[model samples]
Target chain A: DVKVTQSSRYLVKRTGEKVFLECVQDMDHENMFWYRQDPGLGLRLIYFSYDVKMKEKGDIPEGYSVSREKKERFSLILESASTNQTSMYLCASSLLDRSNQPQHFGDGTRLSIL
Target chain B: AQTVTQSQPEMSVQEAETVTLSCTYDTSESNYYLFWYKQPPSRQMILVIRQEAYKQQNATENRFSVNFQKAAKSFSLKISDSQLGDTAMYFCASEHTSGSRLTFGEGTQLTVNP
Candidate 1:
């Protein structure tokens, strides 16, 4: 089974604090993604990386950034936490294939900003 | 750009009964993929089913199956013999065959009643 591990299941941060969410995959997949899930908005893409040391902004990347320094690791960074940024964050990975494979996901990190 | 749409915000079904969740997508690409994902209270996003655009037959996984209508740009999920564990938020998503990103729609909250 493919494993996507997020560092934390729940996290709390104060406003103006920097926060990091870590994710690691054992499947050697080349593509990784970060998303925030809200009640009505669903999952909005925050960032995605297709290769090590490469990153691309997604639909809602304004306050988020990603780092993929290794094929197995992807990190999401929030420069400064805010109450509005609190949400369930998810990490996922997929193989670098043209067949459109399904992404494997982690349990997620529910971040709370106060 | 691709877009996914899930019109149903909430749905309920009795245990052992069947329920279908609807999804629609708009894209200009000829080849792509569609998916249905289930997120339980644990908040782990699980891949429920996948459908390739070129496949004429819908995809099925045990009690879960999909009704993929390519021409109509529709992909719906059918859950049979539903159980309490089947209750979750179901999300519809689309991905291009060669793209590394996925587009997700607003989710449908499913409740399984005894």
Candidate 2:
């Protein structure tokens, strides 16, 4: 079975602190994504990486960045955490084949910024 | 920009009944994909079903099926014989064929009453 592992299931950070959320997938997928889910707002894409060292900004990319140094690992970075940034963070990965591939997601990390 | 919308914010259905959740999207791109994802209380986002835009026939997976109306830009999910385990937050998402990013709807909180 494909497994997507998140580094933390829950996290708390102070305002102005730098935070890192890690995601690793064992499926050898080529596409990885980071999204923040808020109540009544659904999941908004923050960033995505299609290949190692390649990244693209999504709809709500401000205050967030991504790093994909290896094929299996993708990281989401919050330059300066703020209370408004508190939400559930999700990581997903999918195969490179565009035909009909579905993304596999990890158990999200609930981040609380204070 | 591609946008997904779920009109229902909350839905409830009795066990062993059928329920449908509505979703609509706006995009000029003809080639794209639609997905229904379930996020249970466990906070794990799971892919429930998917439909390719070019496919004329609807997509079905066991008790879960999608009514895809390409011209109407509507993709609704029908859950037959709903169970208590089916209770979750259902999100409709769209991804363009040219890119890897997905746009999600506000999501519908589904409660399966036993």
Candidate 3:
């Protein structure tokens, strides 16, 4: 079975603070993604990394950045957290194959910005 | 750009009953994949079922199955003999076979009343 682990299950941060959400996958998948899920709005992609040091912006990438220094770890960084950023963050990983690979997700981190 | 839609925001069903969740997507690509994911109270996103657009047959997994209508671009999930453990937020998602990202629906909150 594939295991995707997130660094934090819940987090609280003050406005204008820097925040980091980490995700690690044991499957060594080549593609990793970060998404923020909000009520009514659903899950929107924030950023994704296809390989080490290679990142791409998803639908809603503003105020967020990503780091993929290693194959097994992907990190989501908020330049400065705002109240609007409070939401459940999810991380997922998939194999390099794009044809028929399904993404495996980690337990989400619910971030609260005060 | 691809977009997924789940019109029903919330649904309820009695235990041991059957329930269906609807999903629709709009995309110009002919080759793509569809997925249904369940996120229980634990906030872990688990893949429920998947379907390839090229396949004419719908996909099924035990008590979980999908009604895929390619002409309508609709993919609905049916859960038979639903159990209390089946209560969760179900999200429908789609991805182009050539792309690395997925487009997700807003999600339907399913509650199984015992």
Find the candidate with the highest lDDT and give its number.
Answer: 3
- Lowest-lDDT window of 10 residues in candidate 3 chain A? A95-104
lDDT by residue (B5-111, candidate 1, tens digit) is: 99999999999999999999999999988889999998888989988899999999999999999989999999999999999999999988878788999999999
Checking candidate 1 for backbone clashes, the offending pairs are none
Per-residue lDDT of model 2, residues B2-94, tens digit only = 999998999999999999999999998979999999999998888999999999999999999999999899999999999999999999999
Report the CAPRI category for model 2: high
lDDT, candidate 1, equals 0.93
For model 3, the stretches where C-alpha displacement exceeds 4 angstroms are: none
What digit string (tens of lDDT, one per residue) describes model 3 on residues B1-114?
A: 999999999999999999999999999998999999999999989999999999999999999999999999999999999999999999999999988798999999999999
lDDT for each candidate structure: 0.93, 0.94, 0.95
Separate DockQ for every predicted complex: 0.77, 0.87, 0.81
Off by over 4 Å in 2: none
**A1-114 in candidate 1: lDDT tens per residue?**
999999999999999999999999999999999999999888989999888999988999987778889999999999988899999999999888846468999999999999
**What are the runs in model 1 whose C-alpha is more than 4 Å off?**
A98-100
Instruction: Sort candidate 3 into its docking category.
Output: high
Clashing pairs in 3: none
Evaluation by lDDT, superior candidate among 2 and 3? 3
Q: Is candidate 1 or candidate 3 better by DockQ?
A: 3
